[model samples]
Each structure stands twice: as structure tokens, then as C-alpha cells.
Target: MKLSGLKSVENAHDDSIWACAWVPATENRPALLLTGSLDESVRLWRADGLEPFLPSPSTGHCLGVVSVAAHPSGAVAASASLDSFVRVFDVDSNATIGTLEAPPSEVWGMQFDPKGAMLAVAGGSSGAVKLWDTSTFELLATLPVTPPNQQDQQPPPRPASKGSTPGGKFALSVAWSADGRRLACGSMDGTIAVFDVARGKLLHQLDGHFMPVRSLVYSPMDSRVLFSASDDAHVHIYDAEGKSLVGAMAGHASWVLSVDASPDGGAVATGSSDRTVKLWDIKMRAAVQTMGTHGDPVWGVAFRPPGGAGVRAGRLASVSDDRSISLYDYS
Candidate 1:
């Protein structure tokens, strides 16, 4: 696979653009790119021009937008901010569908289930994954990612502390498996927790990094494989089920802030404080292409979802602290 720069929108937002997602295409329109920024607003962009599709910006998000996710159906999308609010709104009409908040539990990463039945959010500092039913707009559960090495579970000297507690975990990012049976979350302390969706229990803890893992994406083609980008400036691949470290690829000069896998699952893309976006070949475990288009730290990168009529070409989008967004044609 190869990536060629297609378009760049300088100062796309007034502040750092921290999140991005590709809203699925609909019968009336092709897929569109959605981005949220530290500027406290979310903007939509078509694949062609970097123009804002909506005449006015969607406001109401206090503080800064931390993450964005589009529902599978393409009718709605959601954005989470540091304020702990998950705002769900229509993709086209831009109407507020619903807003969810698990107070005392700040929000981080979020993704809708493949079937669009539930929305799983990474509970910041809550040390758990919060699930919300799409229809009821009610929280289903807060599945905690408890570490197994608890001292209390053992006899005598017990584990020093229940570092496994959700608060101790300080969850940062989350990703669901292709089949939707498993969920994995990354923490600020560099621990990864894998859980069974049905059983709602912690399965394993995968270890490889020493810094905060800010972004994670499970391979769309392989449910067992997972990719993570961390502040340590490395991208680590893991076998989520086996809890084994598959590989670690490092090149960025600064923190790797965000990562996403291609729909075909052959490659992965990452944004970093190094102010560059790097495309890595998963099988070869190496960086094949590097694009230095942003002068500031890149915060988010998203590959367009594979769908939409007559849309055969591939696209990758990245947003940076330079307050700009860049698009690439991937082939």
C-alpha cells in the first residue's frame, strides 16, 4: 500500500484538532470526515474540498473535544470531551439526538458496536468501560478492568495496592473486536486490559509499554490482533487473546498520540508529537512511508470507512496541534 498527499487544510480549527472519524456514506451523500478540536467545536468535511459542510459549527461542548466516533448506520455520530459529556447528534441535519454522561467518570475513547446496538466509552479515571444502549440512551454497565495481580487475592503480604481498580488503571483508550465479543482498553500506566463482552470480566493484561497509550485500534480483518500507540514513541502490536507481545515498531521522535488500522488490515497509520504521520506495514513491522505535513504535534489519524457506492479509492485523514487537517490518497 502507498499513500500520496491529496489535500491539506491549514489551521482547520482555531485550536489543536484532537479527534477524527469517517461517517459512513448514506444514500443521499458520500461518506464525510468529522473532526473535533481543542477549539471546543466539531466540524464536518467532504472528501473533496476541506470546506465545512455545515454552515455553522456545532457548539455546546465545553473545554475541548477529546474524541469522535460515527455510528455504523451513518445517521448519527458522537463526540466526547474532557467535560465528561457524550453528545450524540445527527450526521446530516446536525440535530442533537441525545447526550450521555456518567458523572465522576470522565470520557476518553469511544466506539459504537458493529451492530450499532451499544456504545462503549472509555471511562477516564473511572478505571472501567461504560456501555450505553443506543435505543434507551441508558448506561448498561461499567465493566471494570481489574488487574489479576491483586495482593488481596493472594494470601498474607497481599498485593501492595489494588492497582487494578479502575481509578488506578486510569483508562485512556478502548477498542472492540470485529465479532463484538471482546473489548480491550489501554491505561495511562501502560497496562492493557482485555475483557469478554458477554461475561463482562477481565480476561488478561497485555504489557509492553511504559508510557501512556493514548490510541488503540483492533484490526478489522483479524479480531485477535490489536495495535496501540503510546507516549513512549512506539507502536506495539499484541495478540489480545493470548496476551502476548507480538511486536514493537519505533521511529517517531516524540510521543505517538493516535493510531488507526486500514480497513484491509494490511497497514496502520499513526500521528505523533514528532509532527509527522507514519504509515507502517504490519507484516514487515516497519515504517514504509512518512509524511511531514504538519508543523505541530499530530493528535489524530483516521482511515475512511470502506463503503459508499462507487467509492473504491482509499483515504486517510490526520489532524494536528498545528490546528490543521491533512488528507491522503492511499492505494
Candidate 2:
């Protein structure tokens, strides 16, 4: 229920680290940490020591790597950038598996389905979430995000001018439910779109924040529970199926950039522009501890996924704009 700093990697990247994920262990090796940064490279590190797994960082991404997702099998992973391309590569060999792109639509947040059969990508400006087949790397479907009906807006207010518009719903983040039956995506205008994957239908919209939502993740223990990080400087927990804002937590002094649910489902961790990472106790709905070790905005936080040989204790990681990566023990 608390975090203790274990290892710190100074200057882990030439620029800011925008994303991080733990690649589940395969028969050959233990779980490894994967990071993407503004330096236009993706790097792998040993989870225990933060040592670079490869001789050099993997390169080729342009416009800065912004998001990264590892396959459930841990054999392959994908990294997306502002350049509108998602490069799928082998985890061990780092060889290119396939390149995916939905022309004219930029890629943002991404997550592989629980079964590792599909990849869900937040399609910026396209106003949709794109699903791709993991085996063929071919486009599977696009679920468009529709603006809610005027009456759907609580207390229906008058429209504002162009200058005051909150911008269109450009999908900024995506997360798949535990069962892979549901998927939720966050947008530029602060709306969360929930979809039925099998039917490819937009179920409903979850409303609360009025600013851009940058990150989202489903609770590992509950399919209906969802958490989102937004520019409004708050983390909102929602019941995705019921379309209700179940709870809200506010403590971050600036925009919350990233969020992750702990393996046990008892707590969550968030990174903020306030240059700190906080651990929130889910039952209490409050921040139990704050770690302010980064000098710049903390951009990415990840809970090491459960399950690896003899890996029982919990581990957490945070990457920041200060060009550092820090690991913590959660117990």
C-alpha cells in the first residue's frame, strides 16, 4: 500500500520518456520494461536493475514515440508516434513484424486485447478507435465516437462560440475491459466513449471532466470499472457499463498525465505535471502517498504486470520529462 524508491536511471533517454509498459515474460526470459521516448527510440530494460537489455536503443520512429503496448504473449510489441505509424516488432529480436497505419488518422494510446488477438488504437482527429488484427496486422474495424445528444448533456446548456469550443472529440486514449468484451476511449473534449467490441457498437458516453483526457485503464479485477487521467488535474473513476462517474480524486497540482491500476486492484498510481507520482488507495478514494522525485513533469507510470517466475512482490515504474526512469517497490 506504499511505494519505496528502488532504482533510478538518470538520462535514460536523450529526451522525455512518453510511454512505458511491462512485457509479460515468455519461456525464455523474465518480464522486461519497454519505454518509448521523444528521442525517437524505444528501449528495453531489465526489470530488476533497469539495465539496458539491448546494446543500443531501437530506432526508426519519427515525430517522437508517444505510446507503446506489449502483446499478451510477450512475443511482440508496438510503438506509435505522431507520424501516424504503429510499428509492431518482435520483443526479443527487435525485428520489424509489421507496420500499421490508418491513413490521415494519427495514433495515440494503444492496448492489446486480453487474448492478444487484436490491438486497439486511439485514432486522433479521426474521431474513432481503430482495431487491428494481431496476426495479419490488417485493419479490423473503426468505432466512431459520436457527440452525445443535446439532451444527453446534463442540464442542457446553450452552445458557445468558436473561441470557446472545446474542440471535436479526437480520441486521445483507449483501454479494453478485462474480458475484452468492452473498450473505452477518451477524447479531446473530455468524453469517454464505451464500445461493444464484438458488435462494434457505441454503447454510451461517460461524462464528468470538461478537459482533454490523456490516459485510461480498466481495473484488472473488474470489467465494469474504469479510470481516467485528464488535463483537469483530476482522476475520475467510472462504471463504464452503467455510464456513471462513481468517484473522483483530486490532489495533483497540475495536469495528470498517466495512470495505472495496481495488480491487486487495491490501489492505483498516477503521474502528474506537478512533477510527482501519487499512490491512491481505491477503497479510501484518496492519495495515500506521493513521491516527488522527478524534477520535471512525470509523463508515464506503469504497474509491472503480475505473473513471472517467482515474481510475487509488486513493482511500479515512472518516466518523466526530466529524462529519467524510476522504479519503486509496492507493498
Candidate 3:
């Protein structure tokens, strides 16, 4: 797979663009892109011409938007702020549907289940993953973080020790299994925990990264495969169910902030503080293509989902601290 520059929107956001997701195409429209920024706003954009949709989506977020998750139906999506406000809004109308708030538990990463029936949020410093019913927009449960191998109920070693720390790491990123039976969250301390969604139990921890893991994605084709990007400047691929780190790829000189796997599951893309975007072939466990030399750190990267009528060409997007968004063609 290769990535070719398609378009770059300079100053895409007034502040840094920290999160992004692709809203699936509907009958009257092609797929649209959603971006959240530290500017306290979330904007919608059309891939064609890389132009912004008129009317400036929404601007009520208090602090800054940190995470965004799109519902499976493409009718609605949610955005979370540092102030712990999760806003679920209409995609086309920009009308607020539901607002979820829970104090004492800050939001970090969030993702909707495969069926869009549930939403899972990584709670920062709260030591639990918060689940909300999407339809009702009500808090359902808080699953505590506990390492599967906690001897005598003691937490693992501190981070920075090459992941000797077992559990209770600060949750930084979250990803749901393709089947929606399992959920995985990466922590600031570089530990990734897999949880049994059905049983509401801690499954295990996958160890490898020694720094904060900011982004994670499960392969669309395989529920067992997970890809992670971390401050360690490396991307690790793991079998979340097997509880083993199967592959590691390193190329960035600085922290890797975001990672997303291709729809085909043949490759994974990463954005790094080194101001670069890279594509790594999963089977080879090596970076085959590199793009970007932005002036500041790349904060987020996302692959367009494989749906929507006539959406054949592959697309990739990256947002950076430089306040720019870059689009690429992956084929």
C-alpha cells in the first residue's frame, strides 16, 4: 500500500485538531469528515475540494474537544470535551440530541459499539471505562481497571519501566472489538487492557509500550488484532485475545500520537510528533511508506470506512498541532 498527498487544509482549526472520525455516507450525501479541536469547536468537512460544510457546525464545547465517535447509522455522532461533557448531535442538522455529563471522571477516548447500541469511554484518572447506552444516552456502568494477573491485588510497576506496571494505568485510548464482545483501552502508563464486555470483567493486559499510548484501533477484518501508537515512538500490533505482542514497528523520532488500520487490514497508518505520517504493512511489520513534514506534531489520523455507495478509493486524514489537516490517497 502507498499513500499519496491529496489535499492539505492549512489552519483547519483555530487551535489544534486533536480528534477526527469519518461519518459514513448516506443516501443524499457522500461520506463526511468530523474534526474536533482544542478551539472548543467541532467542524464538518466534505472530502471533495477539502471544503468545510457551510454554517460552522457547533461551538458550545466548554474546554476543548478531545474525542469524537460516530454512530453506525451515520445519522448521529458524539463529541466529548475535557470538561466531561459528551454531546451527541445530528450529523446534517447539527442539532444537539443528547448531552451526557459525569463529574470526577474525565473523558479521554470513546468509541461506539459495532451496532451503535452502546458507547464506551476511557475515563482519565478514574480507573474505569464508562459505558453509556446510545439510544437512551444514559450512563450504564463503570468497569474498573484491574490487571488480570494482579498478584495479591497489587497494581503493576510504574510505567517507564518497559511496561512492568500491570494495571491501573491512566486510560488514554479505547477501541472495541469488531464483534463488540470485547473492549481494549490503552493507558498513559503504556499498558493496554482488554476487557470482556459481556461479562464485565478484566480479560488481560498486553505489555510492550513503555510510554503513553494516545491512540489505538482494532483491525476491521479481525477482532483479535489491535494496533497502538504511543509516546515510545513505536506502533505495536497485538492479538488482544491471545494476550501477546505479536509485532512491533519503529520509525518515528518522536512520540506517535495516533494510529488507524486500513479497512482491508493489510496496513496500519500512524501520525507522530516527528511531523510525519507513515503506513506500515501488517504482515511485514515494517513501514513501507512515509508522508508529512508538517511544522508541528501530528495529533490524529483516520481511515475512511469501507461503506457508502460507490466509495471505492481509499482515503486517509491527519490533523496536527500546526492547525492543519492533510488528506491522502491510499491505494
Give per-residue CA lDDT, model 2, range 59-134, as digits (tens). Answer: 9687688899999998899999867799999999999999997654458889999999999998877778999999
Better of 1 and 3 by lDDT: 1
TM-score comparison, 1 vs 2, better candidate = 2
Question: Compared with the true structure, what per-residue lDDT tens digits does model 1 show for residues 18-61?
Answer: 89999999988889999998888999999757788899778868
The lDDT per prediction is: 0.86, 0.89, 0.84
Candidate 3 versus truth, CA RMSD in Å, comes to 3.3
Worst 10 residues of 3 by lDDT: 157-166
Model 1 lDDT on a 0 to 1 scale: 0.86
Which is the leading candidate under lDDT?
2
Clash pairs, model 1 backbone: 127-166, 151-158, 151-159
If scored against the real structure, what TM-score would every candidate get? 0.93, 0.94, 0.93
Query: Weakest 10 consecutive residues, lDDT, candidate 1?
Result: 156-165
Model 2 pairs in collision:
1-331
